[model samples]
Target chain A: MVTRSFPGRYDSLAQIGEFIRGITDKAGLNNFAAYTVEMAVDEACSNIIEHAYGAEDQGPITCTCKVNTKGLTIILEDRGRPFDPELVSEPDVTGELEDRPSHGLGLFFIRQWMDEVEFEFESGNGNRLTLYKKRTTASTKSTRQK
Target chain B: MEITHTQYKHCDLVKVKGRIDSYTAPQLAETFNKITDDGRFKIALEMSELDFMSSAGLRALINTQKVCKRYNRGELVLVAIPGNIHAALDLAGFIPLFKIFDDVLSAVGNF
Candidate 1:
């Protein structure tokens, strides 16, 4: 298990990506799986920075990654405003192109990519978002061929 | 991320390379805004070299597409989307939003 904390700002996205990439690569996750995990974590962190901390608040987002036989697990910790994931409505993805909405896709993407996602709020710990992705044989084979 | 534009006969071709996350999505949005502002509504985004894209990138595309639709002149199309990016679009249920082609020339010609 490896854990690192970054400033809750957009600028830290690159570092977060690098951190995810290192762990996924070390764990031998295929490109597709690794990319999926990276994007999921990216969206999660972005939400914490934008929605939780808001633009005016500069907090710290701590990320911990663990890889085992099952798959990779990522935990994002932020001491910002508490948020309820269930309150986010599903995006109208089937809507006409002209009427498509943009704001809700981040949480949508996060839920779609990760195998499991759980959000918890603690009085002192703030918000903890845990994301999990399972490695499949298909992913390993596809990645090896690439 | 690097965005390069080329003027075609029927549409404008924008080729994107590198990752499109929260930090870089604004640049893409700016490029699309500039293209539409210049009255070039028929556009083809070539994504063969684009390595990765998050929801922020998707939002930029959706916003620009809305702009093109609002003008009633032409539409923005996507071309040569890589497998991962295409999967992301599919997962987000956004595949049907635009005309997607396998090649840039074909996408531009359709405009």
Candidate 2:
């Protein structure tokens, strides 16, 4: 288990990606799987920085990553306004190009890429976004490839 | 992200290098805005060197495409997309939205 906290700003996104990449590499994840995990986490953190804290409020987003035999779990916590993910209406992905909505793709990508995701708000914990990705045989095999 | 554009006969070929995330997505948006503002709607993005892209980047592409189409000008095409970035676009259900080509020449030829 490894935990790090970063300023709730867009510049910290690369630092967060680097941290997750290091852990996924050590966990024997393939390049594709590792990249997916890194991307999913990046989207989640961006949401927190933009939606939760807004542009005026700059807070700290603490990320905790745990790797085990089965898979990896990442928990992101931020002290900002909490909102319901359910209220975000799904965009019509198949709609015509002119009709498609431009926004709301961030949370959509997070849910699609990660194997599991959960969001919660607690009195002292602020907003906690948890994401999990399981290790697959294909991922392990790809990791062994040159 | 670094964005460089080359003007062709029918369309402009924009090459992007580096990661496009929340911070740098604005740079991409600015490039698209500049192209569309000039009434050049037929655009092809060469993304072989784009290492990473977040949803913000996706939004920039979508919004730029929308502006182009709404004005009855043209569309935005993609060229030489990396696998990981392609997967991101695929997962977002954006694979079918734009015309994707294997090379800049082919993409420009489509315009």
Best by TM-score: 2
Residue B21 of model 1, lDDT score: 89
For candidate 1, lDDT tens digit of each residue in A44-113? Answer: 8899988888863479999998989888889999999898998999988886776677888888888877
Please tell me which predicted candidate would have the highest DockQ against the true structure. 1
lDDT of 1 by residue, B1-111 (tens): 899988876778899998898989999999999888898889899998998899999999888888887748888899888888888887776788888998876887787
Q: Per-residue lDDT for B36-82 in model 2, tens only?
A: 88988999999989888888899999998888777577999988888
**Per-residue error (Å), model 2, residue A91:** 2.0
DockQ for every prediction shown = 0.54, 0.50
Candidate 2 overall Cα lDDT vs. reference?
0.86
Candidate 2 lDDT tens digits, A1-146:
99999999998898898899999988878888888889889988988988888862479999999999988999999998885899898877887887878888888887876889999988766799999988884274332110
Model 2 TM-score is 0.93
